[model samples]
Target chain A: MTIDPAAPPPRPPGRPRSREADEAILAAALDLLIERGGGATSIEQIARRAGVTRATVYRRFPNLTGLLVRAIEWEYRNTTPEALSWPDVPAMVRDWARHLSEPRSRRLVRRLYGTVDDLPELLRAYDAAYGSHRGRAVRNTLEHASAAGELPLHCDPETLQLVLSGAALQHLAAYPDTTAAQDVEAYFLAVLRQVGFPSPPPAHSTPPRRSTSR
Target chain B: MTIDPAAPPPRPPGRPRSREADEAILAAALDLLIERGGGATSIEQIARRAGVTRATVYRRFPNLTGLLVRAIEWEYRNTTPEALSWPDVPAMVRDWARHLSEPRSRRLVRRLYGTVDDLPELLRAYDAAYGSHRGRAVRNTLEHASAAGELPLHCDPETLQLVLSGAALQHLAAYPDTTAAQDVEAYFLAVLRQVGFPSPPPAHSTPPRRSTSR
Candidate 1:
């Protein structure tokens, strides 16, 4: 697995795990996860695909479940809670919207959700590692926006979280095939409007409007 | 499966299916569905649980898959698309909000979503049955509300659908504990505001307000 550069170094041990072996195993597991999914992907298959010995793969990850978890984290490294841990509402929303608008992102989300029912451990692990990441991302970003005077002082972070996650879930439902940036923006604008946001026409053009009168 | 009251009756030769037998089997299947979920529940378990022979259950449902579908319909008959086919945004919103506010309803939704990944057919059956029910319900209701001049004439049904589903999905996330009517209504009102609806205090009170002098 690709460790974050900022993360502390691996713990001291008698023999260190091979960095190259770790990458190959994770890469193989990641592909199987998407192609075959949770219940179907096997450690044996991962070993074969990675061209690594089963003993070597098991030595690093300990079990198939642990390996799968590491693979998920590795594949979706860009979507990690830490990656979205910043506090810029528009930037975060735009970033999130753009990412989720992709078909591949939708598939990844679907795969994750597909397993949430059958794999309780995965959900629990995600809740801890990601801090229930989707909700946290929107809540933190909106809170920052409200504090920054970009949103109403009384903007309800909880409600904004609701709008965000809700749109995301339904996006998987109604617009699963939609990968265009404009489509994501339409949904994003609709959400901002729902929360009483005085949305800028573009990210950089949020001018205040004067009420038109005859 | 039990046909809707308006739906035409099933045809021809064989002796009529016993109402009591159908109810018992459905009740058993529903309980098992919630208790064990889609994967673990089976025709054998359902037959044993209902105190009916395997042949009897199979005769009515054809297979475990069909039985599960009927059970879903049976458990959620009240929330079925036919039940919400009418166009009354306020009433529809109230009903939808109330249904979603129930803990049982949330559990049901979670269970259904939990299986959507592995069981594409379940999702397909629901989409066909409900006509993407969440979006359709919101759109139909908003159409009525708009025509009645209760909301802005320019209100977008598709956008409203997005907001409603977004809120519902978020409800599944952050507000799993919220069963209050007021909580659902709070989210509902935010959606109305997004659409520029001059929301009345209640269904009975929609008086136009005079602008206050500063």
Candidate 2:
């Protein structure tokens, strides 16, 4: 027997906003960012490229900075760690280094970093978001290592998290053009080895217990 | 008998550039930076504060970025490292941390880092200059430690250099508002302890050996 047809949807609105238009605008922003850098990307240009009016773009995003930020977030979401599986600590670190050192990622960082002079608020927001998200992951990794005895019992997990995240960010800042993936991996391994991780032969030494006197 | 008198020298064609004016401008720029963030400091305001015409300021520096950069370099030159005798590796680390974590140093770094987005060329020049100067000091310390058998013999000095510098910058960036000088000292001490520095009690159960593999 044939199934009964569902009732038709109600048409209460004049014209529904198009999801395709939103995606198009985001894509156009990403393209512009890749081609001209972040400072040069404009909402008007994005609207024109997406075949939408400037008002439509503004209606979606309150300001240029907001639009740019969302566009970057969208691109980052699409091209980040979500799609990939990280099997082990070393493998995960390698993946992270590779992703961060890519040309597109470097350009995005350079563009955002350059905006700190004129847009301090945006810079603060970027740092806050980046730290909150990435910092948590690094902290979790260190904590797990500590719990598993992969890290020293005396290891300060918070400090380790800070060092890992900070070291990674500073490495990117200093060597924007060069991909020191192997060096980064080796550096972390050295740190891990220092922190009582067993590699080849077991770690030769233990970290000292805290001293009572300063 | 009386000696013959020397002849008077000829007057210069034009008044030599005023050292006082240069010093005044630099001092004013620094003051303005401390009061207002780097982005808010202007060449016109700096010139007015220095009691020099805009043309004179331009004659000294091509633009505001150049002026600010020169002022920063001047500040760096004036702040020479204090003559302190460190009794041990931990003591040295503590001294270094205290110096960098001071309010004056933090303010300078915040201003420079905050402005890096707007002035890429200036920022590049600043980093290159800062790195070269700081790198030399770090190299000396590392070399001394290696010579004294303080560091792992197989450790790549350049890699260690990168790691230490990256770590220091990251620490500063992470705790921009924190004045926990002791915490900085403790953090480095932990790292040093992990790396097998010769603490008084020698906490490690066994001695660390240089790794054979790269």
Candidate 3:
């Protein structure tokens, strides 16, 4: 552990390297939330888990609510695929199956729903930051499917969106354990079929192309 | 309001008339839970609201968990219709619409979901006492519909049950405010149509008879 005189001194609090600390703090908050639910989580616990001082955490996030909201937003950004990347409904379904199959995802979702009464701001922040964007993307996909004649003639896009979202919630509640990604995807496909989605996902006349941005 | 010595000594604490006090306490517990959410509710408040002593409540139920569980069960018994009473799925949908339109019902359901982590026992008790029974009934209804050609040929009864239950949850999360019963019913019917339920409801050959038990 020789100190190199030519090297810059260890970075102090609020230094240019603070971005690294910021990410660490947010990641730690999300981890603690998933492992120990909302009621048991605390700033002290998060700081300890992140290997930072309490002052470091407080300097970055003045309050627990702000920190939690930021942490959840980070998780959404890191885990969810970009809304515009999916080529079709089946692609979206496949991505959702992968997300839902993970036990960590299910636990985090449960905490979100379970905290609505206590910390409604968290859900509101999520809705504003990610939910609305994802919802619009889904609606667009459904509309395209309807136009392509892949959906039932009378199917309403709004109702279908609600049904699909509800089905996800229902799955979390009904099955708390981890499941195989393929099985979950298969189940959602069956639900789609029941809801008038054509089997084989309607070979697009234009053959939808994957987004090149990703 | 004169006390008569001939009035059977005012009915001691352990008398058979305790059922009256039992109902009062349970009703009060539910009222407090709905009005103030789960985290803020307590036995003392329930006792005061019910016009009974705290000891009376404790005598009937030893713990908060037991009291809340029984209170929720009592609510289900009083509000939900018998499983066998519905002549068809449409009838059940109508009843659900009415239930969903009530602000009190929605708030109570929110509490149930919000307390899942803090009070896992409460949700588990509910699942055992009422959820399983209601789930079976819904499954039976869907199965009947499938046999009668009301549902799509590819529709799976289990999947449909999950989707319908999920839709109810999604409705609650999306719209926290009370809606017109007719609007809710219409929305649900549209969902059913999307899931392959024939519109205008099926005309029964036997003219499905409503149960006369009531």
TM-score, each model? 0.69, 0.70, 0.78
Runs off by more than 4 Å, candidate 3: A1-17, A44-56, A79-84, A201-214, B1-25, B35-60, B79-84, B201-214
lDDT of 1 by residue, A10-68 (tens): 77664344777898999998777766666577899999999998988888897888887
Weakest lDDT window of 10 consecutive positions for candidate 3 chain B: B78-87
User: Could you tell which candidate, 1 or 3, scores higher by TM-score?
Assistant: 3
Model 3 per-residue lDDT at B79: 37
The clash count for each model shown is: 2, 1, 0
lDDT of each: 0.69, 0.64, 0.79
Error of 3 at A176 (Å): 2.5
What C-alpha lDDT, on a 0 to 100 scale, does residue A191 get in candidate 1? 67
How do the residues B1-214 of candidate 2 rate in per-residue lDDT, one tens digit apiece?
Answer: 7555685565664544577789889888877775555667799899899898889899988788778778777776644433334544556677678877787766666556544545555455555546455566666677677777777544545556655666676666655546678887766766555444444565686779889899
* Model 3 DockQ class: acceptable
Best-performing candidate as measured by DockQ: 3
Question: Of the candidates shown, which would achieve the greatest lDDT relative to the real structure?
Answer: 3
Candidate 2 TM-score on chain B: 0.69
Residue pairs of candidate 1 with colliding backbone atoms: A166-B166, A167-B166
Error of 2 at B39 (Å): 7.1
